[model samples]
Target: MWEYTDKVKEHFLNPRNVGVIEDADGVGEVGSLSCGDALTLYFKLDADGRITDAKFQTFGCASAIASSSALTEMMIGKTLEEAEKITNDDIASFLGELPKEKMHCSVMGQEALEKAIACYRGETVPKPEGNIICECFGITDRQIEATVRDHHLVTIDDVTGHLKAGGGCGKCHEDIQAIIDQVQGKPMPIRSEAAPLTNLQKIRLIEETLEREIKPALHQDGGGIELVDVDGNRVMVKLRGTCAGCKASQVTLKKTVEAKLRELVSKDLVVEEVRS
Candidate 1:
């Protein structure tokens, strides 16, 4: 677990502005391209153009969730201008401090807030425009280059966590790996030397496995699994339906599916479960 500050722990445990507004004046969604974190913000405006209410739903790590919660709490009752001025620094300050590495998570919340305010004011939030680079998180060449040059990104995952480009769908992993290779002037391997699996190939294998081996067994218990990614022999998967919050998930992963994968694939294959 992350060594969260008091503020982060407080907000996370009793997260403020957690639900959605029925008659929201505006809604905005921002997701980090690298870190697999996403947030959706909803707001209700008053007659005086003050933010009457705000809420957020976050899908990410602790910092991302806590940042989104803190951002919503800070924006409530603030005027549009005031909310617009709320920076990443302000958010981090509110939380006392955050891990330097998790600073980007707070920044994501600030960016989302800005986008939400822009949407409320009928301003055009500029869509990322540049050569496509990281297909996983839809990160552009400009975003990657800027992050590399300015932020001193040392690894592909670091770039992904900051920009959110190669953190999703797994389609851009190879491209991102290539970019990291170019940036470092040497290859940095994110995957092992196992035979690579294409999206289609992985999908087919997962579907076949689920249909023939896993799903039928899970159906009996009203549980299921979703295959998220296959990086070399490292298979990333998500528990879904009933299996998600089940207490026995670890047992299922370690004793059953992971065991089967290791037996079928390379013995070196490692199965990792992602918490949603």
Candidate 2:
């Protein structure tokens, strides 16, 4: 588990402004549940165009909730001009610090604020334009490039932890690496057909896939997976905790587990459930 600052825990446990502002003067929304995080922000501006009220509804991890809560508190008394100046870094700073792996939560808060300000100005923020790079998360190549530059990200894991661009099925790893290489002025490595993996390499990748792509989702539901054995291309596993009895466990295995392994490990791989 990532260690969160005391303030992050405080705000998450007792978040302020957790509601809708029906007659809100400005509203901003960001993220999607399919991507595992979402937030909506509402604010009411007083006669002098100063923020008088701010609130938020968020669906995400503790970091996301804490970031949304902190964002509202930071903007409630500020003018639109002042609030617009708030950055993702500022949000992180206010909470003391977020786990590096959860920095995207802060980024989401910043984007919501930008959208809200645009709404108040009666201007439509154009959809982000770029070729899709991370198919699982819908992140774009331009976004990856920009994040690599802004955060000085040096590795695919850094990008994944910060922006979730390469956190999914792992097919985007090479593309994200290419973006990082370009941004940092490194010579791009040759891309060739991958050599056949040894048994150990395959097992290692499977464990990594479970950790990076599967565990967090199950953990959210009070469940977990245990890798039993890897025999050739068949992966035997057992669900533990709440997942053991979940009615949707089969669905989870098919849609999430198998799909993730196919994308990240070997396309020929099959996932099967084993009883305890």
Candidate 3:
């Protein structure tokens, strides 16, 4: 479950401008039910090219509905340029703040607005032209790169939360990981042999990787890590300082810690935060 602000609750419970305009000047639709969220936006313009009315029909969770409602309210009386200037961050800010996992709702709203404006201009909705990477969500490489650049996303989980990539099937995890690495200017993870290892060997290799690789990287960000135990393929560790309480601890644990261990120790390795 995610924490929602009171404003978010209000908008979702009583979403303004629900339903669509029968004769809208601009209409945009985005997302799909399979992906867990979708939004359809409509806007009408006045003689002077100002938005006179805006409405939405959303099929998603509470956050998605709130985002659509907030978007419509934000567009009233604004020119297309002004509406275009409104970003996902702007939508999030309008309703206080959204939980990290729910950021995609605001992003969906932003995409719908862009498509709607494009429709008004008699132009095709500008989609990022690239091969589809996340078949589960119909996300493309260009979409992933754009979101990573826009949000400064650093991990696969962050990308999943924002774009729903790597959230399903688990087959696209590696691909999403590669995209994150490329966008962040990091080298690819080195792959090694997947041979059998004794428990003692596994423990030793995990410790060596933590000290020689993971800790230094985390320390640079004012964080620390410690090995607690190694039970079979599961490596339980404790995050120290800022990293322990940070909302992005899951991302750090998976993308940084587990990834490093997998490259150097065993491909079957799984990292878990030993939360106190």
Candidate 4:
């Protein structure tokens, strides 16, 4: 259920250049079918070293196809040097804005362009060197580090949204978190060095987090949260207004409410709902 922009939808529904050039000067292929996304870029350069034609064939969701189409269009009329300067952020910016979770689709376009340029120059394409950290998507530690540093990612979910590293199975979440901390220069807490929280301290922090961080966000969507009770590490809450019976309430509770509480209060904090 990604909210795609009008431009994204247009390119996806009717891609501009959807074929290969038999005599392309540069051909770059990236991604994998197993990952549910792939793209191939073709470009023909004129005698003046300016790209005269660019085309692409992409297999993925609407955003993926749109990103590929947009990339090819952008490459047309640019010199190789100019095209090389294009980044994933630039592609997303060109399309106005992409949903956070679909940002990786633009990353794929960037990788394909690099590979295509390497093919044109007859340079050796570097292989992935780091150990695999996310098995579900075959993401490597080197990939994670580069993405975290490039994007200035701060949270595990940000990494997930950008690279989908910790979105499946979640075994690599701790490793992803560690990389985020290193990139952001925030040290991960060591259990022995961490200060213990009293019951009163935990309760007060939870209340403050709900008031300061969670409620304001919910209120924007015509929903709200009421802190019902606190027992040990458990936080009982009641959904009010529109959120009370919304079909997406469970997702809100887990991904939004519980996630915020755990991030601000304690890692072991659990959130539950109380019915009348």
Candidate 5:
């Protein structure tokens, strides 16, 4: 649970502006399903082009919900320019401070304000561009690099917590882990009984094994393997079509698929079957 301030907790528990306006002058939405946090902001402009009303709807954790609520409360009655200048720091400060790990929640509020301002101005904000690193969260390589450099992130978990990258379905956990390895100038950590592979590494290794071994075996069985994600050391793999009801599925996962992946990659990997 987050150690939220009284104000933050109050607003979260009894959030204001929880729904959309019927005739909003401008609206903006950001984050996404993949990111595990999404926000929709609605604004009503006055005759003087100031924000007479602001409202928000958010789908995320407690910090994210509180941040959106606070943002809406602060922006109402402010000019669009004034609202645009409200930074993440300002939002956090207004809330009496957020957890360092949840600082990204405040940043999301800032991003939503910028997008709403862009909509009011009829400007087209550019889509984030770079190699797609975290497919589960739609986080780009450039964003990850920039965040790591700016914050001096030293671990893959730090990067994910800050950017919400590898926090979801976790398909890109390995790619993120590789980035961490490269940045730190260390070889990927050797998985030992004392130091097990991280969740991200396990996910990556699972994908690698599926592509290299398990997929071919399933194809031979007139079935296929779809890599879902990794949560902790548990690797979730979905069995499709004919494989769903097959008796051999458990045998394949335990004896063949799990064994082979563990042998080739890390001994800590735990393969789990998921229904497609």
Candidate 6:
């Protein structure tokens, strides 16, 4: 464990507003259990559209919980428009600076707050442009690009320290390096054009995408899913736990699950449910 500031320790030991607002005006959820962190933030608005109360439910490490607690404390009393300006850096600053490796926790808090505000405004979170980069973490190219450009990150380790991008499997290191070089105007290495992926490679990518993207989102809502079969471009899966009998299970399969697979894997891929 890296050194924790006194404020981090204080918030971790006694977190604030650790429950739900039954009739909340906005709710935001982010992170995933598969990645070892998840957060759900709730806030209520007063007559004047000011945040009157805020709460959260989080499943993560000490840093994540502390960052979330700090976020709620900071969100209360601010208007939604005002709260929109809060950034991950602000969350970490409120805690007197989190360890670099734990900066993603503050990022998650900021995302949840943004999502909650979007829900309040009846707006869906637009999918950020750019493909997925870190398969193990479900981080996207847009996310890494913004993080690098915003924070002036220079190394793969710096990106990982702040975004958890290259911290898993190590396959994304080269891609990350290219992104870093591109962002800083450094000359990127010349490379041959890529060949098509083998069947085995596609399977591996599908599994990683599920682990990094799909399952975690399902897990967020007390539901779960498992890969049942992959034949040609058809992907079959079975819902588990709370998702098994959900009336919207098919919607989850098509909209959330299949859409993600298509976006991350191959556009021709189709997702179908296999009840078993």
> lDDT by residue for model 1 over 91-181, one digit each (tens)?
8889988776687777788878878878777997887778887654557877676565444455777776566666657677776666665
Clashes in each model (backbone N, CA, C under 3 Å)?
A: 9, 0, 0, 0, 0, 0
Q: Who wins the lDDT comparison? A: 2
User: Per-residue lDDT for 28-139 in model 5, tens only?
Assistant: 8988765678899899999998898888999998889999999998999899888888988788888898887787888799888888888878996677779988776678
Q: Rank the candidates by TM-score, best first.
A: 6, 3, 2, 4, 5, 1
| Pairwise lDDT winner, candidates 2 and 4 | 2
Model 3 lDDT tens row, 1-276: 679999999999999999979999999999987787889999999999999999999999999999999999999999998999999999999999998888889999999999999999999975678999999988899999878755667788899888888888979989988887776664444545756778997798788677656765787788888899999998999999789999999999999999888887888889998988
TM-score of 5: 0.59
Q: Per-prediction TM-score, please?
A: 0.53, 0.66, 0.66, 0.66, 0.59, 0.67
RMSD of 5: 18.1
Residue pairs clashing in model 4 are none
Q: How many clashes would you count in candidate 1?
A: 9
- Over 1-276, each residue of candidate 4 has an lDDT whose tens digit, in order, gives 888899988888888888999999999998888888999999999999999999999989899999999999999999999999999999998888899989989999998999999999999689877999999988899999878765656688888878878888999999998887665564333333188788998788888677656775787788988999999988999999899999999999999999988877788988999877
TM-score, predicted candidate 3 vs. hidden true structure: 0.66
Model 5 steric clash pairs? none
RMSD of each: 18.2, 17.4, 13.8, 13.7, 18.1, 17.8
Judge candidate 3 at residue 59 and give its lDDT: 96
| Regions more than 4 Å wrong, model 2 | 186-276
What is the lDDT, from 0 to 100, of the residue 93 in candidate 1? 84
* lDDT of candidates 1 onward, in order: 0.74, 0.89, 0.88, 0.87, 0.79, 0.88
Residue pairs clashing in model 3 are: none
Cα error, candidate 6, residue 148 (Å): 0.2
Candidate 2's residue-wise lDDT over 224-250, tens digit each?
A: 898999999999999987999799999
Better of 1 and 4 by TM-score: 4
